[model samples]
Target: MSQNKKQKGKFKQKLTDKYRLVVLNEDTFEERFSLKLSRLNVFVLGGFFSIVLMGLTFSVVAFTPIKNYIPGYSSTILKANAINATLKADSLKVQLAILENYTKALRPVLTGELAPEEIDSLVLQQERRIIDESRLNATKEDSLFREMVELSDRFPLVSNMESNVKLVFFAPVSGQISQEFDPSVKHYAVDILANIGAPVKAIADGTVIFSGWTTETGYVLILKHSNNFISVYKHNGNLLKEASDLVQSGEAIASVGSTGKLTTGPHLHFELWSDGYAVDPVKYIDFK
Candidate 1:
């Protein structure tokens, strides 16, 4: 027991022994600085500095952008960009779907596949879905205002005529009507006997919604005008306007010809529609 105690004391003394570290100027042989440190103090200071260095390194990696440079770490900016790209892709998909549905709905009309009444019903259904007429009740003040406006505008004959005429259609071709619009026989168009290659004009300002050939209509050109008006020029010899082309009233859009299988001779087979319902073009235009 005494020998063990003696060895422990010597070990303790060695750990507690002070050492002097001196810096000297080599040429002058003069002591510039001196520090006294024990073995235990040096070990503790070295361990403390090591621990502090490790803590600094951890802080830089955890809180700073340097973490992105390390493997297995994701960049915050890149993550945000990825999320934004995903959202844009979703939006594009929705837009493409809407466009596809719109094209599908119009295909029948453009191809003349649907009956006139069916087309009208489709338009009516779409209108009903868009507007709730039950919620459009006019108040007493609104009725009174409408009455006042009507009374004030009643006496101006020319102004009244102009106001009543929402759309003024120009004659598509100056020719004698070979066939008048007779919906009872499913003839919802007027066949105007014009010279072959006669210029056919647009009835009003519109966009050419369809300009293509069909088995029954041949070279057909359909225009979509304001106020939900649509005009179709069928059996055309040639189309001057392509689809999506903008045309003005009285502009030549096609040439009359008996191109379709249904025609007997060269003539302009023109159909007019208002709000998806067939309208007699003779009532609105003077073909002579």
Candidate 2:
């Protein structure tokens, strides 16, 4: 117990021992600044100052723009500029697509392939068909002897069919329409007489399902459009696009020519098919 108490006393004394830190004026030999410090006091003061310095460093990086210089940090302006550039690029692409579509629509008009005003005038012309009802006329004796027939098919179910009036169809050619659609004669197309080499335009966006020379129609190009509509341009001078080629509205797909044995002069024979049946092109398209 005595030896242990002696060792403890020596250790405590070493830590509590005071020392003088003094500075003297060189010439006068007088003390200028003096401090009485212990070993324990020196250690505590050094630790406190180190902690304060570290706190200041942390504040600078956390609250000031200098933080952006760190390895993983980014500035606000740089991020905002990046976002703006990406958005601008997307918007420019959309604008370019619209311009391309407009140019395609205006090609035929600028090249004088078709008259521009014909489309507007054709829409104004009301569709009319004269039916010869003379076949319905019956003599008095024949009418009395005629058996009563149910007129079920007379007022047919025409209400459920789709109407093509609202659909926008481009003029396939610009010329005087020579022959109109006559279902009675099995002629389901219109013959437009135009000068040679006149550009023939696609009526709408479609794919060329048939583009080849035929014995009956000569050089023919057929496009299949949406909503089960198909367009046939026959008697063409040449085919610009081939089968399976994608075409936009008003794009040039052929030229006017009388290549078939059936045509008499340079003209375009255009046909429009809806569902499985053939429809009148005059009712849907404006071929001048």
Question: In terms of TM-score, which candidate is strongest?
Answer: 1
Model 1: per-residue Cα lDDT over 132-217, one tens digit each: 33566899999999788878875767876885666679999998999998765778899999999889999999999999999887
Q: Which 10 consecutive residues of model 1 have the lowest summed lDDT?
A: 126-135
In model 1, pairs of residues that clash are none
Please name the candidate that would achieve the greatest lDDT relative to the true structure. 1
Stretches of model 1 off by over 4 angstroms after superposition: 1-149, 153-165
* Pairs with backbone N, CA or C atoms under 3 Å apart (clashes), candidate 2: none
Candidate 1 differs from the real structure by a C-alpha RMSD in angstroms, to one decimal, of 14.5
lDDT (tens digit, per residue) of candidate 2 on 1-288: 999999999988988999999999999989999999998889999999999999999999989988988998888889999999999999999999999999987787788876868755654443323233465478887765543332334643352243443278899888898998886676888999999999999999999999999888899999999989899999999999999999999999999998977878999999888775677788777665
The ten-residue window of minimal lDDT in model 2 covers: 124-133
Q: List all candidate RMSDs to the true structure.
A: 14.5, 21.3
Q: Tell how far residue 177 is off in model 1, in angstroms.
A: 1.8
